[model samples]
Target: MKQHFFVLAALCFAACSKEPVLPANIPTDNPALPANSFTTFNIAKGNHYCDKTAVHVFSDSSMSVKVRFDSSCIYKTIDPGNQDDINKLVGFTEGNNNHLHSARFGWRWSDNALRLFAYSYAAGVRSSKEIATLAIGQEAKLRISLLPTEYVFAVDDTVVTLPRALRSGIANGYWQYPYFGGDEVAPHEIIIEIEEI
Candidate 1:
C-alpha cells in the first residue's frame, strides 16, 4: 500500500511540473527602416477639414503600429467618442466595432492646411494634459530599431523606446493612412505611438 501511494504521488508531481508555454509571436530580430527615407506631409489648416499631400508607403513585414494612451490624458479634448474612431483613424475599421481608441493615430484631409493631432483624448469629464503635435512641414521618420530590450521610435533621429511588454507583441508589416473626423473646427493630422504594456 505504501509503495502504491508513493508512485501515485510521484506521478502527480511530475504532471504538475510541466513548464508554461510562451506566446507564439514574440519578436526576436531587430527591424530596420530606410536610410534617411521617410513619410513627409504638409500640415493642413481649417475646421474639420484640411488639405495634405500624401506619401503612402506601407511598413515592412516585421514592423507594426500600435496604439498607446496616457490615462492621465483622456477626456481633455472635444467630447466623448467611441473606440471605433481610433480603429478608423488607423485604417483598422472593417467588420466589427471593437475599436480601442486609446491606441490609434492617423491623418485627415480638408480644404486648407493638413491638420495634425498627435495624442488625442475623447471628449469627457476628464482633465488631460496638452496634446502632442508636430509642426507643419516638419519632417517625421518612423523607424524600428533595438536599443537593448526596448523597441525605439526614431522620428528625425529623436528616439523614444516603448515598454517591453508592448514592444514584443506588435504585429509586423501593415499599412496605415491619415484620417480625420470629429466636431473640431479644423483639419488635423494623426500622430501617435500606442503601446499595451
Candidate 2:
C-alpha cells in the first residue's frame, strides 16, 4: 500500500513538472544558404534577431497566414559578398544556383515603416523595388500569392500588384522563408509570429 501511494505521488509529480515545449530550432545547415556560418535562423512562432538574417526557404507551395512582428527597424547598407548583410528578409523564389535568386514579395520594415519589395538578378545586376507600405504592429492578415501573371500582396483584403521577374518568375514558385535582419546584432530579441491559415 505504501509503495502504491509513493508510485502515485511520483507519477503525479512527473505529470505536473512537464517542461514547456518549443518548436525545433532550424538545423545548423538549414539548406537556405549554399554556404555555412550564417546559422541564425529560428523556426518558432516569434523570432527577433538582428544582423541581416534569413529563415529557411519553404520550397513547397504558396502560403497565406497571419504574421506578427514589432517594428524594430535598423538600417544597414548591404555588402554583396558578405551573405550575412543581405537586405531581404522574405520573398518568393526561383533559381537553385549560386547567389542568383529571383524573388518578389513583401513585409520588411524601412523608413520607420513596413514596405513591399520585389527582386531579380540579371546581366550582372540586381533589380529591386520597394512597391508599397503598411502600418506596423497593426495585426494585419498578410497574403503573398503568386498568380498566373503577377506577384500580389493582399494585406487585410487590399491588393497590391507587382511584376514577375526576368530570371525567375515569382508566379507559383517556392516562398523564401521569413527573415529578421539589420547591420548589427539585435538590441533586443525580435520575435515574429506566423500563424497558419
Candidate 3:
C-alpha cells in the first residue's frame, strides 16, 4: 500500500509540472501573427540609453512597450571581463533586467498568448546586443521561435525563418537614471526593440 501511494504521488507531481502559463489572449494553434514583420537595434547607434528611456513603440494602441539596460557601467568602473563582474553587473537591477541579459522582448495590449524571445548576452560575455521583435496581429498569426544551439531567433511559417542572431544572455537593468552618472554621463550601448502581437 505504501509503494502504491508513493507511485501515485510521483505520477501526480509529474503530471502537474508543465510549462509556465501563457497569457489567455493568445491562440494555441497560431499564437504569432503577421509572420515576417519585425525591427532590430544596433548598439552602434547613439543616445539609445538614458533616464526614462523608451526603446520601441508598437502601432497597436492596446499596448506600449520598452526595453532598457538600466545598469551603470560608469559607477562600477569595472569592465565585465570575468564571471564575478558579470554577476555583480547583473545583480543590481530589478524586474526583467535580472533575468534578461542580451535580449529584450515585449508585447502590446492586443498580444494575447504571443511569445517574444530575445537573444542577448552579459557585458563581459559577448559583443554588441541584438534583438528581434515580431508583430503578429493578423489572421495568419506568426510564431517567433528560439534556436539556442544555432543562436537564431526565427519566425516560422511553413519553414524555419531565421533572423540575424546576436549574442544571447540577460540584460542588467540596474543602472538607469540619476545613478548612472548623475545626469553628466549618458548610458552607452543601450539597445531597444519593439513588436506587436
Candidate 4:
C-alpha cells in the first residue's frame, strides 16, 4: 500500500521533531580554577581541645599542634544568639543521614572579629559561611572540592559552590580536627597547623 504510506510518513516526521534540554555546566563562582580542582589534606595531628582536655597529638611532617588551652582567654567569644558553638553541631559529615558531602575551614570565633569560617553538609542539610576576618596567627587556606553532585568551598581566595543529591552519598570519607562539641576547649596557648598546600 505504497510502503504503508512511506511508513506512516516517517512516523509523522519523527513525532514532529523534539529537542530541548541543556543544563549542567558547574562552576558557581571563582573559576580561575586549577591545582587539580581540589583534594589536599595532610595534617599530622596536633589535636588538643580545651575544657576537660582531649588530645590526639601526632601528625609527623612538622605540622605542629600543641594548643594546650587551659584557659586564660586571650580572645574567645561566642554567644551571639548562641548558635550553640558555631551552629552545626557542625561537624564535617560523611555517609547517611540522607546523603553527604562536607567541608570545613578554620579559625572561627566570631562576635567582634576572628572569623574565617566555611562549613557545609548536604542531603541532611546544613550550611555556613563567614568567609574572612582573622588574626591569631593569621594564615588561611581552606579547600574542598568533592563533586558527584556538588560541593566546592575554597577559602583565602573565596569560592563557594553547593548542591548535593545523587543518592546523597560519600562513602570515601575522613575528616576530624580537634573537634570540640557541646563541651568546648582551647582558650589559648595555641599552635595548630596540619597544613598541606
Best by lDDT: 2
Candidate 2, TM-score vs. the true structure? 0.47
Residue-level lDDT tens digits of model 4 in 1-197 = 99999999999998996675434553223221123333222222222342222222221111211111111213343433432354121123354231244555544455655554556667657666666664564555565555676656665577766665443334344333534322344343433333334
Q: Over the stretch 1-197, how does candidate 1's per-residue lDDT look in tens digits?
A: 99999999999988886676545664323222223233222223342322332222232312333332222112222443422132122322111221311222333322322222332222211111212244444434433443333444433444444322223333333323333344443233334332211
Tell how far residue 110 is off in model 2, in angstroms. Answer: 4.1
- Best-matching candidate per TM-score: 2
Writing each residue's lDDT as its tens digit, candidate 2 over 49-118 gives 3333434445533445555555443333254333233334455555443135344343454445666555
**What CA root-mean-square deviation does each model show from the true structure?**
14.8, 11.8, 16.1, 16.1
Off by over 4 Å in 2: 1-61, 71-89, 97-101, 104-111, 116-136, 165-175, 181-187
Q: Whose lDDT is higher: candidate 2's or candidate 3's? A: 2
Candidate 4: TM-score? 0.24
Which of the two candidates, 2 or 4, achieves a greater TM-score against the reference?
2
Considering TM-score, which of the candidate structures 3 and 4 is the better prediction for this target? 4
lDDT of each: 0.32, 0.47, 0.28, 0.42
TM-scores, all models, native as reference:
0.30, 0.47, 0.21, 0.24
- Shift of residue 189 alpha carbon in model 1, Å: 10
Per-residue lDDT for 111-187 in model 3, tens only?
Answer: 22222333233332432211223333332222223333222323233223223232333322332211121122222
lDDT of 1: 0.32
User: Which scores better on lDDT, 3 or 4?
Assistant: 4
